[model samples]
Target: MKQFTISQEHISTYPNPIILKKGEEVYYGKEDTEFPNWIFCKSISTRKSGWVPKQILSTPNNSGIAKVTKDYSAHELTVNQGQTVFGIENLNEWTYCKTQNGEFGWIPSYCLSST
Candidate 1:
């Protein structure tokens, strides 16, 4: 496994219990669905925040961006494995969003993998 760094200072400010920093990676899941697989990839940017996944409001992580509630398709959204989303808005509750290019559509929260 590769070494990664996580922060805890911003956890209290997130809409959820977790607060992801600008460049950190962390695994997010609960119970039987813990660890290894089923991870959501996330990255924090200096964009505005208003709504995200309601589920994340309670289970926030300090090292990954909160998951969104949109459906993502390669034909709809132009996202690769290592691309970062820089136009997200209203990330306090579950809200679907399209990329700046309009190629990508809403990205469901469960499909994201951080780290």
Candidate 2:
């Protein structure tokens, strides 16, 4: 696993994240203007809404509905500057990571530095 240091503090926004299984459907909303790679979506089954990375969402039609290409969790980890984490995956401009306490979530790539 790749090690990284948190270069900036990050606070998780969503307490209850949107969890989706592969092939699950979601109603697409709008793309985040600040984080263009993420789009707001609501799960069709759960009706839970959150910001989901566009990379995991299939192409939407005119009605703005799409299927999830893979299992995903819109979970973010809150970390202080200089904290260490292990990278699990990289998607859209974020990194999925596991912290020392065994908590796992996504952090913006810009806030991490290879250690």
Q: Rate the local accuracy (lDDT) of all candidates.
A: 0.32, 0.93
Q: What's model 2's lDDT at 30?
A: 90
Clash counts for the predictions, in order: 30, 0
Candidate 2 stretches with Cα past 4 Å from truth are none
Error of 2 at 60 (Å): 1.6
Candidate 2 weakest lDDT stretch, 10 residues:
28-37
Cα lDDT of model 2 by residue, 24-91, tens digit: 99998899998788999999999999999898888998888999999889899999999999999997
Query: Residue 2 in model 1: shift from native, Å?
Result: 26
- The best candidate by lDDT is 2
Instruction: State the displacement of the C-alpha of residue 27, model 1, in Å, after optimal TM-score superposition.
Output: 39
lDDT of 1: 0.32
Model 1's number of clashes is 30
